[model samples]
Target: MRKYGIADTTFSRVDMGKIAYKIIRDEDDEAEIIRYTVPGIKDLPVAAKRLIDEGCDGVITLGWVGKTMLDKYSYLATSIGLIIVQILTSKHVIDVTIHEDEADSEEKLKEIAIDRTSKHARNLVKLVKEGKNALTKYAGKGLRQGFRDAGEID
Candidate 1:
């Protein structure tokens, strides 16, 4: 059996818990979901900490960082906070976010958010339920911003 938690921010339109729920339930595995909603990106770490303290084997934090300069700085702070939370709690905090600039329109943003959230949820299962063996499936290999998914240059 595995237990998981979802930390979502109230400011965003994306619903990470709902996405995670669909994916987790499809696996037909026994698991408990603890949903924690936070005010914004900055609160993600604290909410994740709460889930860890609650005995959740893993946590998935879903949030969005707008393209504004202030939001970007806030995202950096949130990322650092999550790092600290992981070090202190000794638990997995899967942070999934879609930067506002990643998509040019609202619909595009929603599409990206849905894709990122669902995929990361699967990763959560791979880690907490299957252990370290999940690393066998690596990502970002031979991929670059401009090169996209192309293999080695040479």
Candidate 2:
């Protein structure tokens, strides 16, 4: 009965969209999933907004940033834009971003992408099905998608 949207960028080196879509499909069977593929990170905000306008309860935006000053600026802009879209639509827009420099090797990059996208997709399912309270238990628990949790502070 619920509708969810996935907005991904083709600029990513890894196929994060596919991973996310698969995870969502496997995790939630009752919800409807709609996906939009864009050319770059900067384009994700609009895509996500459109999906929300089309009646999605939430949207997951996936993007990859390069190891450059320009890329960093672009990422910041994209992030801000996503926030704006969320505000305008009064919907949840989960931003999942990976920086190319985060991993030293291609294998590591792929691993990070898979882990991050999969986890976020599951989170999306939780959010749409159970609402924000489902995630409140994780507050201050030091959670990380691509890597291990930082653990709770004593």
Who wins the lDDT comparison?
A: 2
Model 1: CA > 4 A from native: 139-154
Cα lDDT listed for each candidate: 0.82, 0.92
- Each prediction's TM-score against the native? 0.88, 0.97
In model 2, the worst 10-residue window by lDDT is 22-31
TM-score of structure candidate 2: 0.97
lDDT of 2 by residue, 61-80 (tens): 99999999999999999999
Give the lDDT of residue 66 in candidate 2.
95
lDDT of 1 by residue, 26-106 (tens): 753788888998889999999999999999888888888888999999999999999999999888898888788886788
Clashing pairs in 2: none
After aligning candidate 1 to the native by TM-score, how far in Å is the CA of 93 from where it should be?
Answer: 0.6
Backbone clashes, candidate 1 = 0
Error of 1 at 66 (Å): 1.5
